[model samples]
Target: EKSIILLPRQNLEICSRRSSRPLPDPRPASLPPSSRPVERRRPPSSPPHLRSIRPSTRPRPPPRKSRRRKNSATFRRSPFSVPRYRPFRACPRTTSRRCTRNGDSREKSSEIFTPSCVIDFVFRWGAFVLTSRLAPSPPVPRQGMPGLGRGAKGTVYVVTDPSEMLKVLHNEGTHPTGAIQYQWPTKRWLKDVRSHLGGGDAPGEDHGFWGDGPKWKRMRTFLQTDLLTPRIAKGYLPGMIRAAEYASKGAPAYAEPGRFHIFSSRASFDMFSSVMFGEFSRMANPGPETSERDRMFCDHALDAAEYLFPMMSNPRELFWSAVGVRTEMYDSFSNGWKNAREIAMEKSYAFMDRASEDRLEGDFQRRSYLANALRRQAEGDAVTREELAEMGFLILSASLDTTSALVNWLVLHLALSPSTQRTLRKELTAAMRDRGAETLVPEMYQQVRTLPYLHAVLRESHRCTPAIPINVIKKNKASALEIHGETIPQNSSILLDSYSVGWDPEFVPQPERFRPERWMDDAVEGRKGTLRQVLDHKMYQKPFSQGARQCPASRVANFEVLTMISQLVLDWDIALSEESEKSVRSFQDVPYYQGTTVQPVMPGFSFTARS
Candidate 1:
């Protein structure tokens, strides 16, 4: 038996199954010459599968020479043919086969193999999943929704959800790591400089601010127990009041009218110097002939420390420094460190001498941070002179900038919100009147702290304009951190966006509006509740951060700011100068910048003594 299959548009031909003879060319008589198909015979030994019991006599059409000239209408009109541009659709009938174009082949089959449909489906869905997992999140507007993002440093997990943030921090086991500490940039730069100068590259044990492990613990404990405790912090009240009195006296003659930050900075330095080093800084006092030179040098040093970290961290600045294009910045940084170190050393020596004499005379009343450290040293503690100097510098740097910035921001907020300022003054007046005090005195420090409205304003200010916008980078070491439903890998850098959480509507209703009332118990009505209730709802306010590694001077900072604000509001009426108002208005228009902190850049304001 023999069989033959008729291909589409092919000419019909015949051959005997038992004979190997070639079949005659069988062109159909009715077909045109150009449309006729060529004919060929199958071998006698052809496979049985290729053989057919019967052969069709119809002739097949000629092969397509070029598809470019073919009528596209035919394929478009045919239900079996797919358009080249459109995605391939699955055929309705699985058994149906049609002569369809398959790349360059012209063939007939029982089923068409179209994997493009599956590929198209997977590509579209797979891309979305991958992008969501890997890509950085979008920018958050002032009043926009919050989400995760990425930066040059590492992954930035921005959680606007207070509860979620609390969970992450709460579970951040002891020794929670934060973004590279501010000190690292300068430290690394200095280390490189030392290495280039033929110093060994071997790492030394970190001490003071940047130290971790045992050293960090010891330093933190010493600070908490001996210096920053509430009692110890309160002990600085007399010094703080003196600084405030000096600031009030010199408020009128400061370099600029509304630039009260100058006074705040000087006052903070004076208070910190007196409390920590047992010497008063005459920085805020007016002089006839450069009497404030040392104070100015101290200010320059602190400013240098601030700009040094940023300059070192900035690649462009580093590049410029390397090529000697901008040597001024490098010189400025070097001078700043040198001046600060010299000052720290001088103060350390003075304290050591005073402490030794005090110990000989049995005079424990002159106790100061330096004196206490000296006492520890005398008791055979391992504290070094270099360590003491470093700690002093760190304390001055931390206290001056942070407290000055906070006081500046708080006063700015009050100046902008006059009604809020009036309310605060009223509260202060009532408290003072109740105590029959005409002026804020050392004894009234405790009373001023208890003023609910004043404290609320401070809390609200800290929340809205966190001194450190994103808490220092926190690192998880033990296991992967789970936030929301996503699992952050182990040892990943965690950045809690305090700015985002501070403005989140869930924790703070009308977050954009500056309303101290939101924090008052009497103001908690309608949909919004009291500040305590809100804090209870999600303990989200972490201005000083929450952990063992939290800022050690937080209580002292609070006391300093509270005392300054009380004195200023009690004795002076503040309002933004015209230039200051314009600057503040512009700040409102575009409120944020990505940097070490995210707080309002306020304008200067004039202060008038209250009659």
Candidate 2:
């Protein structure tokens, strides 16, 4: 079989999971040679504020170091630690073939990978069993469906043609927008207690998903009311800056030899926690009650998250079909739920109380999203206290995972494509200079808002490897998505698979390659008119989402990513991990086949600070 096949690879003409491929190289346009050619040493100039710091003002305790050590879990080192993997709450967007957890995967999953989900009243659906597991590209598209092809996700998908995809998103297909039908899970599978992954919730209480579709809908509304505003996002900048700083110059513990990373999976997780939750996390630097609380909460949350997301078409059906059991993963899930409930409840109530008290006392701040949520709740919008909590919870969970996922890819790009990295650094440096500064602190914040190169990097990173492989999934309930001329059916979930469109040659010339400049100007080296037009036109719909259901915190996410990159570029000269960067063998578990939150899957690279 040919090494590469068209996306959404079904059982036909597919290769085995053991197959390996190379990692993606950064596009030529984004990183200019002039930028990468030169090298800089000496740490990036420290924040002027840090340099001016004086000795500690707090009085030190007398040397009473004789205290005996207690159980380590007694105090946590950080505030934001949560169980990293949750089950059904959020599905992995990009799934790959099975292998040892080492993440070495064949780079074959396509743009619209769909898990094979079929329930005849009840049964657990294995996400695997794709075309790679079966035959070849020799299977052509079915006549009526046009563009419908098979791959990992499902045997038959909607349209494979990029043009048709856009039409669907714009409501143009005969199938119409919102025409897809979603399915309910099976009863037999649900009857099996082993399949249930319950979490840390009070016995018999409705923890969130233990209810109905209306609950989710209201929670969705609550999220819309509070999180999407610009005000809240602006307040979160400090978190991104802090995380970026740590990444560029890591803690003393992990900064070792040739492949040490200032920023790793941990950094990304921590950064997001700090920004979204304020200072309440226990993972910041554990060793207290907060630490223990944070750990238990995160772990439990992940456990619960696991069973929350199953590709059964209808999540509600699955929950009701299966009785909550106490299996190992279920126990973990239950604990996670308990923790998530506690945290979300605490934060949600606090937000509501604060916002309410402020308003009642005639001391409310200016208009903002939180106020909107409050208003919705007041107007009987079903924006319950728990629902509000879920909103904050989603921000923490979604933003962090997606952002970190993208960062992972960015690091891989830098390591494999030094030239591209250098070029980006130059553009960034020029932007900094234009701001009349050589330092890496306060002023840089302002610089990020205006830098074209910085924006280019952010956009290009997304263009090449969307932080979340799956675009927003919108379920059309009332009716089908009626497009330009056609009418899609009701109850259909329409997904604008940005991955497919991003790789489409028409929208993006040489779709597979990375090209930041393509977004800035027309394709220079034998390509199309311009990538920006495609992006701006919302080609095949945006990965970040659009309209009412778009990502509320996009602005903040963008700022955080840009700031992190700016600081990283300013602070260090980085390259891919020596082992993983080798061109001969491709990276294992690259973006193409990851399930849900699929992102860059490479190791840390070598780095040295710029003086």
Candidate 3:
């Protein structure tokens, strides 16, 4: 027989046969009262094995009182919610690594403070401090800090004070070297490109623009004696004048109403080709076939210059090549050099043929730079065909872009300043009147140099718009030198910031204004007073650089610029077009800075023939 049993307050029932042993309780004592198992009646239809395991059917007990206090808002708040508290105290110098509250040490503080984390924090903050110290500052500093600043490459001592700059340049010792070490990359890339294109073997050594030491000395001497001398530079004036006239004639047809760089480049090409090759390119009026060839050749040369300059300035770009990784920059330079080599070779061979024929005539040819070089070669000079080609390439590259840039700036400046234009035109008119010639003859072009105002305008323009803003880097060859009581380390790269010197208010008052009169001498008390101009060449105005490594073509470049400006101003009434005028005004408040040079952004103008 089976019997049902109910324990007091337990609400549980158990059924067992008289002979069967009772089962032990399955529920543990730790369960709360509400969760404790309760007895329930088993349904008759349930299986026999499940009847003893039926779920408790007793009603749940009432919920016991909550242990937490009865604050409805606080009870519902998140356990991890941040509490309102006062700001932490400032870190003490003695115990900055530890955080304390009420002078009690907190657990897990050691985990938050670790050596690696401290080191990481230090490194990150240290880099920020160092970068702030080394970054380039504005031309005029807000803090009135010293002119000395640090660059990524090296120390840059900007000497805006004219007197200080004069002292530094004047004391630049013999065998002075510049900071521009582009020759290495240029030579390497040129060789690689030439080899890839099967354009003869690599150059034997760096010479001309690429060389230093005795080889550079010899080349410099040869250039100074043969082509760059004032006498030789004067001889090229007629050619320059004719080139200018040719350019002026074609300007209206080729130049769009406002755009003029293309016209300036063609004019520069014509002049440089005639003077350097003794052959006229007539680039301004080329045949259709020749026109396309000229365009391609010029594009290559320009592309080479654009890429090579930035690459040489940054050493990281060339580091890839050191690791045997060829880059697009390298490839671009290679193609450019290859094309330049072809152009140089063609011109060199033509010059050689002319020289050989001229030698048979028993009369020396010294009319053009090429003829002068060939004369030196015929006279048993040490210059070789290879050197001639190299020199030819250098001259071609240097002359074309630099002269074109100068002409562009000069024309733009003159166009904007109507009063300055009137003054310049009056000077030219007076010069022509003195010569008693209505037309500008070759002699009149030469006489224009004597005009004080014309030369002043050129000087001011050069000061305002230096083609190369930073003069080529200079290095001390022998030992450390002292300038302004500062010792520059030996073999250290020296950079003269020509832009700062040009714009310094101490030397050039009202520097932002275009005032050519500052360069003119005043006749005081029947004698020429101290000219307001910086009289010493070393004192100011190093547009073509100065000292031992000064540019050899300085005189030639000056003549080209002067002749072109005079011709254009005398014959044409020029002004900035409406669009260009608006562009200039936008940037007028701040000084203009462009790539590797200081130039205005707007490059367009309108020209009308003077009645």
Candidate 4:
């Protein structure tokens, strides 16, 4: 629910003074609240990203005269899951080598983590670990740690106190930090897991986006000097609109509507892939020639995800160099990279290969940003072939899941609130009429930033059910600092409590409510309670991210999501599936799922043409 911004200097100073020692042993979940005041400290480096959360020095205001609510009501913890991994679609966009039950084990783990946990954790943690005991047979459990609730088998716990989750990355906070059993570091994770970071592995100098020191400075320099600016991102608008049209119908039917499970995901995949590739291939029905290529790219990404799922639960020594299985998970992981590289080089390199010789724009000034990226690399921008491979894979993986989730949620939310849908449609109607846009063609396109209602819908959907429902890791330079009186040792991991942020009542009035109006008011509701996730919402930052390292593709993604939903809103009416309606009525229910994006699980809806 939250990305990061800079924490104030006072807050950092407090964090700096408190962590001179290792953290204490884990505390009971029901441990009594701390009585001491939270002091401030200086963290290891310059101020870094923080939730757009406004800090309060005074005691929070009491509930209104209408009624008071219990704190417990506000802090309903989101359910927990088993193992977590950086999704295969992450920056590296490949499965972790430890995706089987043959990876590292903790003293506490015996049985492998549950598949539900495996699925959930993989979405949240970016990586999860397990032992051989995870096989169908029962195994062992860790000492002193009693299972918390149902589904507590041999899972691992990363302590997160919301406020100090980043401290864990530094090993200065609670719990212990572990390794990314399926690490793609190409080497072990070299950047300080606890230090504020830039993507060192990002194929250039370390400091790419957010500023830290030299490494981060270089990153900022390169991106700013090259195509990373907002203007350049806006250049993709034509392609974005083209992608939406293609999803509607064109080349090979993208995730045929009747295919159910693959529908939403394939559509978004097409959209994102088009963005990365600089053109939309008609997704009507893959011709034999392109079908294999599509699978090699998208399918490889998902298959890579599935293949690693079970094997990762098995502990490491178990894989044992015995079967001659190397520490690297060549079977599941390597294939994705291998397949992705071949296809990307074939398709994208062809683009690059051709663009490099074009007369007009020297590739760098070409309309296609990717072509420009190749040109930059050629002109000493510091990117390598390996980085480009991951960049393409990341394009598929990251864009696929998020756009799919956003579209599905948009429709679901629209279906449930006819009035809201009506309001939204009115806006789209006027915009379309005013723009006089013709047949939403493949190449004819425009921007949508001025669409206020559209922005609200996307923000509200993100707030209610964030695509990522849990932690985001941050590593900083120097040593770790303390936060909220807890000592965050260097080299540890921290869990950013997004679930808590979304539900914090003090920040959003009627925290459980889904009102977009809170953001419309200018002054952010006048205080701490005013912050919300709505675009105009005082607390609203780009849901894509906040601060320096905010996602580079956010602008393009925003246009794609808005345009896709706008087209649908103007063209179709989404009605709830009877089953989905029934489940929405019940608190304990699951919906559809598109691969790992965890959607309405089986959400059913009928789309009717609307005038």
Candidate 5:
């Protein structure tokens, strides 16, 4: 027999039953004394604890409904209950606006941080970074039209075919040129800067780099006077050679681990500063002490590289900016361009002031780009100070990064090949001796420029790794463009694929090999395979691009690169450091797309002075 115990104080009943069926009632089995069935006394055979209990037969009571109202007030009074309804409230750190769902007011969306937003933001940038590190090519997908892709600004058309690239770049009328979205951060900073400077919206007065039609033509014309002309470029050679001599001395000693880029970047800055800024250049009074301005410029110039790609690839930048949420990345991007612009404008205003006072000194200073522009302005030219400042910023930007990067790549290539260095030195020595110059001088430029070996080396390096791999252009025509029998929609973005085109086996035989001799005019490795023959019969090397929108400073850049290479070869013997070699086995191993330029992750090298 089963025992049963009913405790009135506890309002509970404990009992053991043999029935297999579960109780239908949800309430407790306890009952009032009158309603309870007649209880039988416990038998003596049972234990002492069981002797006090009694057996009974009774059914459980029916479940009772909640008497209190199930409202907001009732939920608050109960310690265990959570509020089912949330009062409508303004979004955190956002404007006064409430969100509603199905006629019920709720907290604004901005207050809640959901998993989806975090996942998207992380995935977008994380995948991009991971793919860039592991993949051999760019992270972007190649689909749609023949070479279609996408970027932050618009649709990307990567034209890898040499013929197609030429067709797109050459047809400027049909496809108006535009700056790469890689420069989006810089452009955005400049806009903010102009507003602060009270240079109110001049809707039609876009700068030449981004503007098209007559505006672009006018800006290019103004720049051509100082940059494109061979005569003026030649005038800067003396200062350039002096700068090169100083740089050659600054090379790291044998067995010392030093970054090739640091050596090249500092040297390029000094070279351009002396040539472009003249007396205003920080390097004018070179000493052991580093200038605060120079430090700021160096530290911040390449900071964009780390921030730009993420900003472009991730759409979250737009959302944050809209909500006035200034992220670390956005701030970094802004600061880099802001500091650079500050320095550029400072130098520009100084140059303007000096021009007004007729205080310009030295031959280089008098013939400097700014002085030339100022003279032109005095002679009825309509160039404004803001325009002049923008040009100055561009010059500074090029010197600080792109030009230096090219120097780094060129030196890296030479460092890997000792024979190439020796060959280059011999060429330089012959060129200098031919002009009866014991040392490198401006007089030997004509001979040095014509050296077949030097030209071959430069071309080979550029072919292997161009400073700017993808040249961006837009199809501005109203009608679609049909190329390779594929129709490219109107206003499609085109990327002249320099890297892929340079490496294409069909266009370049043994494209993977860094053979400078392939560029030689009299190369015996198949006459048709030479760069000269190809240029004559088929496509252009296009390192500086082609057509009306090609880089105006190409001539200036080539001269600077050649001068530095010649000096470095004659002065020091360069080789890759042991640590650097362990990381970078070949050109393919280097990381691509550092700040939209093809500047690789070059670690360091050793420089031994030549006997």
Candidate 6:
């Protein structure tokens, strides 16, 4: 028989007797059968010498307890040996909550570790899923059922109220505009383009539209004061007018039934190209002498524009991009950007080569915006080829997409409304006659720009269909925004719903009707003559937005659109085809804006040369 005794520090000792009896199992019966210790018996027949020996029964010395030194850094698990607490507070957006460990409430004196703080950090920067797993905070208080809603991404507060929107827009500090380039595929695609152009990892603070802060401010000031002002925009009008006339050569092809682009897309490309890149302008105006290389380059540029459209329009592209998933659409955008950049760079090098030799001269050559810029570079301006590439890409992209889309809408609207067209043409004819200009000229820009009817038409068209549907701005992280008696959390994105604002009944009376008279001062309520009275037009028409984040090229866009429309009206009697008219009617049925901008998916149109 054996007796098991527990010694000091939980050590075990066995004292055995030379007998057949077995000691009871030392392990607890509560343990599973599989986990219990097995029993063993001694042999029945023992050797004579072994049988003669008896087990020692004398008490043994106690087992010594294991001890740690007083100054030891090693951790010992005990009820009193609680973890030393480091300060961890919850996110300010969240409320304080009781924390427990192993079903025991944490002591009030001891600091509790809150996982929310870490989760919030990850959520803000890394956009991790851990934050989503946490219990949601109390809903933000709203005022009288405001149209405030959340974005698909995170912490995005979409503001639809006009009054609140105006406040958000003007308060640039509270709602600073940013985050366009950060969206999935756009960010990736831009990076690739920048890399190809030899631009640093990020776009130049001044040249890029997506950036915010001092660099952006300085750039914006320079652009507004020096480059994109009305005066500067007017100076480029001659070149733009010429480009429009050049693009008019291809009107017949676009006029064909079932043609998708109509003519505005190609026309815009030519207008901007001639003004931006002197040599590149020829590609848009292809001829018998036009080379295969130029045609390929033009195709690539158009391809890139086509590919980029979906990324802006489809919100799902952002999700797929975030997950690093490659869809067919993503591949197309990527390849298009790559091919465009490569070909454009080839043309840029050739242009630079010519510029270096001072071989470029003449009124038409001087019209290139790049030529002067290249000259500045040669004279020790801090300009790089990469910057030049970036500027070209920016100009081209803006012209081909945003400007082209605007042109399409303006032209389509004019064609549908023959009365509006006739009134506009009469106004144009009278203005031209006053200046004794047989055709629209750059010098007549000031008069044309101030034309009340023209301005009213542009404003009315924009009101009906805003170019950018939703403009994104973010609230400062350190401050919460209070709008319409509701609290919007800091770090929330304020999506200015320009489209909805345009259609708001409170801001616009009869928002459904296409009434240019609302913008006009005298119209018989709509019958304003040359000597017209100005109206109290308080409509919030910020198509290009307001303040520092406003589109820098707004003036340029207006001038180009006005010039093209004026020239087209004078030279061609544009008529919408049956299919196009049907498309326009259907479009009117649903007044919702589509894509990043308002892209018109019309059937086609016919252009008749006016005799």
Q: Each candidate: what lDDT?
A: 0.49, 0.40, 0.50, 0.42, 0.53, 0.49
Local accuracy of candidate 5 as per-residue lDDT tens digits, 52-128: 33333456456466553432110111111211111111111221112211233333222211111111212232220
* TM-score of each prediction: 0.65, 0.57, 0.67, 0.59, 0.68, 0.65
lDDT of 2 at 410: 66
Q: What is the lDDT of candidate 3?
A: 0.50
- Candidate 3, position 23, lDDT: 21
Q: Write the per-residue lDDT of candidate 2 for residues 152-204, one digit (tens) a residue.
A: 22222222333433433454222222111121121122223322211123444
Error of model 1, residue 318, in angstroms: 6.4
lDDT of candidate 6 over 374-468, digit per residue (tens): 76566663546765666566556556656766776677677777788888888888888988988777766675344778778777777675555
Q: Distance (Å) between predicted and true CA of 187, model 5?
A: 2.7
Candidate 2 lDDT score relative to the true structure: 0.40
Query: Of the pair 3 and 4, which is ahead by lDDT?
Result: 3
lDDT of 1: 0.49
Candidate 6 total steric clashes: 4
TM-score of 4: 0.59
Off by over 4 Å in 6: 1-153, 160-163, 169-176, 192-210, 213-226, 257-262, 279-285, 289-295, 307-320, 323-325, 375-382, 447-449, 471-474, 504-510, 523-539, 578-596
Give per-residue lDDT, candidate 1, residue 223. Answer: 56
> For this target, which candidate reaches the highest TM-score against the unseen true structure?
5
Q: Candidate 4: where are CA atoms >4 Å away? A: 1-228, 249-261, 284-291, 307-330, 357-366, 385-390, 436-449, 504-514, 522-550, 578-588, 592-600
Q: Which pairs of residues clash in candidate 6, taking residues 3 or more apart in a chain or in different chains? A: 521-535, 523-526, 523-527, 524-527
Name the lDDT value of residue 524 in candidate 6: 33
Per-residue error for 184 in candidate 1, Å, reads 3.1
Candidate 5: pairs in clash:
none
